[model samples]
Target: MLKHEKKQYKKVVLAYSGGLDTSTIVPWLKENYGCEVVCFVADVGQEREDLDGIEDKAKASGATKCIVKDLREEFVRDYVYETFKTGAIYEGDYMLGTAIARPVIAKAMVACALEEGADAIAHGATGKGNDQVRFESAVAALAPQLDVIAPWRIWDMQSREELLAYLNERNIPCKTTLKKIYSRDANVLHISTEGGELENTWNPASENVWVWTTDPLKAPDTPETVEITVEKGVVTKINGKDMTPFESISFLNEIGARHGVGRVDITENRLVGMKSRGCYETPGGTIIYKALRAIEQLVLDKNTRLYREHLAIDFAQLVYDGRWFTRLREIMMAAADEIAKDVNGKVVVRLYKGNIDVIQKDSPNSLFNFDFVTFGADQVYDQKDAEGFIRLYSLPSRIRALNEQQRKQ
Candidate 1:
C-alpha cells in the first residue's frame, strides 16, 4: 500500500475530469486516505453538451461535493492571449493548446482548494504524462505550502486494463472498458485524442473519431476570406467587425472548423521522456497563428523579429516541457511581450480546404514602401544602387576568396 505521509490532510480537493482515472480517484481517496474529497472541474470551453452529466457523475463516485466553474473567458483572455502574444509554437507545428491550459487550470484548482480550506489538492494526471509536471510545478510555484496528491504515481494499478479490473472487482460503474476506449481531452480551443487506434501513426483516423471538424472532402469548395485586426498585441476584430475576445475566437473556430483548418497528428516528445501519438484540433488557433505572422511582417523590424524568433523556439520548448512557472519562461515571455508592442495590424486570410492564405496586411507601423518597391519608374531607388549594395553585402566573402587565392599563388 502507498503510505499517506505524516502530513495529515482532512479536506482534499481533486481535479476531476469525470474520466475513469479521476472517477476512481474520488473513491480511492476516501478508501485509502480516509478524507473528504471535493471534486473541482473547470469548464474551459470543452463542448459542454458532452459534459452534461459530469456533476452528478462525480457525486456518485464517492465525492462529498463537486464544483464546476466556468473559465472560458479567463482561459482565452489570460492563457490564449499570452500564447498568441509570444508567438510560441512547439516544434514549429503545434500551438501548445494543452500545455498552456494546464497552468491556468491547475492554478484555478489551487485557488479553489485554498477557498475551501483543503489541506491537500489532488490531480488525475498520469505519471507518464506532461500534465503531472505542469500540475505539480504550478502548485509548487503558487501554493507551495499545500500538500499535493497524484494517485497515478502512487497506485499499483498500472494500465487501463488493470484500472478497469480494479473498478470491476469493487462493483464500481465506469464508462470505459478493457478493450474499447480512447483517451481524450477537450477544451473550447481544441480536442485532443490519444491511445487506442491513435497509437499507430500509420493508421488513418476514422471520420467518426473527429467530432469537432467537418471532413475536408465534404467541406464547401468555395473559399471564405476573413480579416483579423490586432491592437496592443491582442486580436481586436475579425472581418472588419469588432468583437469581444470570446466572441471573435468562437466565431472563427466555427468558420475554420467547417473548412478543416486545424487537425494535427504527431508523435511528440513528452516531458516524462516518452513519445506519445496524439491528434489535436485547433481550428481558430491556426487562423490566429497565420494572421498574427502576417501582421508581424507588417510591424516587426528585421532584427527585432529575428531575435524574437530565436526566443520563440526556446520559449515554445519550455512551455511544451512543462516549465511554464520557471524564471526562464518569465524572462522569455517578457522579451516576447516587448517585441510584440508594435505588432498591431490587420491581416486578411482566405480559408480553403485546410489552408490559411494571407491575402492582405497593413499597419501604421509598416515599413513596406510602395514608392521604392514598385517596379514602375521610381526616383527613391535608383537601378544603379543595387550594384554597390550587392558588392558591399558580399565584401566579406570577396576578401576571404582574394586572400585564399593569394595564399595559393
Candidate 2:
C-alpha cells in the first residue's frame, strides 16, 4: 500500500458526492493527513434526494466548508451532447454514461480546489474502479501541481462496513447503511448499478437493480412515436417542441423511461484490465443515439459515414480509458464535429418494449434520390450506361481471372 506522511497537505478539496464513501472520506482526510477538508459537490443531475442536506452532512462529517456547483446544463450541453455527436458507444452496447460524466465532474472539482487555494484534491473513487483513473487523469491534465489523495489506496479499510464503523467512531452523521445492496452512479445521461447480485456473471439483474427505466415486459402494449429534430447532429427539438439541451434530455428521460427505452447488461473490459459486470439505464441517450443514426443514414454519404463510425470506436475507447483531457480527444472531437455539420434531419422514432425504431427520416443533404433509384424508366439514367460502368469496374477482376486461366493451361 502507498503511504503518505501525516500533515503533507495543509488543506484538501474533496470531490464529494455525499455518498457513504465520500461522507466517510471527509473526516478520514482530516484525521489521516491532518488537512482541512473542503467538500466540493457537482450537481450533474443526480437524484434530488442525493443532494438534499448534503452541505449539513459534509459539515457534520468534519468538512470545514462545502461548495456545490450546478453543472447540469453544462454537463449535458458540453459533455453529453458532444459525445452524442461522435456516436461514442463503449463496447457497442454501453453508452459511456459514467465515463463521459467523469471528466466534467473532475474539471469542476479541480476548479474548486484552485479557487479555494487548496494544495490537494481528494476523491472517493476506490482503488479498484475506473473512476480513480478518470478523476486523477483529468486532474493531472488540467492542474498538474495539485496533489491527489485517494484514501481507498492508502487506507486499511476494505469494505463498506469498516467505513461506516469509522464514521460511527468519529460521531459523524452518515445515513449510509450496509443494507444498501447496489453501488450506483447517476447523472443526467444515465444511471449505472453495480455490486450485489451483479457481482456474479450468471445472476440476472433483478427488478430492484433498475432505478431509471421500466421493465420491457411491463411496458405499454401500444407503441408511441416521437418526432426528433437534429441540427448539426445535436437534438434540437422533440415532438416539434423546441427545447434546450438539458430540457431535451430531461423530457426524453421521462418518455423513454416509461416505454423501457434503454437498458443494457454488459460485462465490459474495465480500464484497470479487469472484466466487471454492470447494468446501465440510459433511456434518453438511447433515443438520441437512434435519432442521430437515422440522420446519418439520410445525410452523410457512404464514405463519411464509414469514417465517422471508425471515429466513434476510437472516441468511445478514449472516453472509457479516461483520456478526455488529452490532445487525441480534441482532434477526434473536431473531426466528429465536422462530419456532424452535414447531419441535419428530422426522424420519427417508434418506441415499444425497450426498442427504438426509426420509422421515418428526411434531410436536405440526403444523397438518396427517389428519381435516380426509381424502378420505373426515367430520363436521368440509361440501362445501357450501367453495362459499360460494370464492365469498366470489373476490368481488374477480369484480368486477374484471365491471367490465372492462362497460367493453368
Candidate 3:
C-alpha cells in the first residue's frame, strides 16, 4: 500500500514590513514550510527610510518576489477619516494607531496572495499582541480558503534571542539587535511604542520612548494657533490652505510634532482581556480630532450630540478590538456620517506644550441662538416660562424626595 501524503502549501505570501520580526520571517517560512515565500509590503505612510532597499532585503532573505504598494491616500481618506467622524478614541487615549493600520495591510496581503496564486499567507505578529488577531481575522473575512500561518503560535523558536540566532545560522542579515529597547509600529496617523521600559507601570516613560515629538518641557515657548476648516467632518483646509486628506495630515504631523502636541502614556485594556502599557505620538491626529469635535459642538443639536457620544464609545471599542471589517462598524460609521452631516465649520486651535485647545469655533449650522441665551431682556424667551418647565422636568426627582421623607417619617 502507498503511504498517505500530507499536502504541502506550495507558495505563501507574507505581509512583510522589513522590520526585525518580518525580516526573519521570510527565511523561516521558506525553511519550515518548504514553500516559495512572496513578500508584500504596504506603504501606509511610514518613514521613507523604512521602505528604502526593502525589495533587495526581501530578495536577499529568500523571497521569490517583493511587492510594495502605497496605500496612504486610501488609509487616510477611508479609514482615518471614517474613524475620526465617529470620534473613536480607545480608552480616551490611544488613537488606535496599530489597530486601524492592520486591516489595510492585511487586505493588501490577501490581494497579493491571490494575484501570485499562493495557497497560504503568513505574518510576523507575536502571540502576545493584538496584531495576530487583527491579521488573521481580516484574512478569514476576506479570503477564507487561504491558509493562515501564524509562526508565533506554531514555531518553537521563541524570544528575540532565538529569532536572531535562527537568522545567524542561515547567514541572513537584519538591522535589529538584542539592545533594541522598544517594539514600535508606525504609520501615517500615529506611532506606538511598547515593551522594554514600558512594561513597568510605575516607571515614567523616559526620553528614549519618544520619537516624533519634542519633549513637552523643551517645547518652544511661543504658542502657535492653527486654524482648521471642516466640511462634513473632514478637514478641508489648514491655515487657509486647501489640501487633500493626505497632505493635510502630513502637514499637521510636522507642525504638531514640533510643539509636542500629542503624546500619551497610559495603561490600557487590550482586546485579549489583559492590561498593557504603551506610549504613543499622534500629533496630526490630535489636531484633527480636536477640530472636528469643535465643529460637532457647534453644529450638532443637544439630543443628537448626546446619542453620538454613546455611539462613539461603542465605536472606539469596536475599532480597538479590530472589528473594522464587520457590519457592526459599518452601520455605526454610517450613523456617524449622518450625525456629522452638518459638521461644517471653522475652528481655531491653540497648540502649546502638548496642549490642544479650541479657542474659537463657528458653523453655518450652529444651533446657538443669541436671543435665547442672552442674560439681557430677551425678546425670544420669557423668564416666567422656566417656572412651569422646571416643575414638569423635576417631577420625578420631586416624587423621589417626597417618598424618601415619608419613609423616614
Candidate number with greatest TM-score: 2
Assess candidate 1 and give its TM-score to the true structure.
0.94
| Model 2: CA > 4 A from native | 1-7
Candidate 1 lDDT over residue span 78-139, tens digit each: 88877777778887777888888888898899999999999899998887899988889899
TM-score of each: 0.94, 0.97, 0.96
Error of 1 at 213 (Å): 1.3
Give a tens-digit lDDT track for model 3, residues 1-409: 1123224679999999887778888887786778999999999999999899999999988999899999998899988988899888988888888888888888888998999999999988777778888888889889999999877777777678988998888889888888878988899899899888898988889999999999988999999999999998999999999999989999999989999989999999987788899999999999999999888987888899999888889988887777788999879988999988999989999989888989999999998889889999878899999999999999999999999999999
lDDT of each: 0.84, 0.91, 0.89
Ranking by TM-score: 2, 3, 1
Q: What is the TM-score of candidate 3?
A: 0.96
List per-candidate RMSD values in Å: 2.0, 1.4, 2.8
The full ranking of all candidates by lDDT, starting with the best, is 2, 3, 1
Backbone clashes for every candidate come to 1, 0, 0
Residue pairs with backbone atoms closer than 3 Å in model 2 (clashes): none
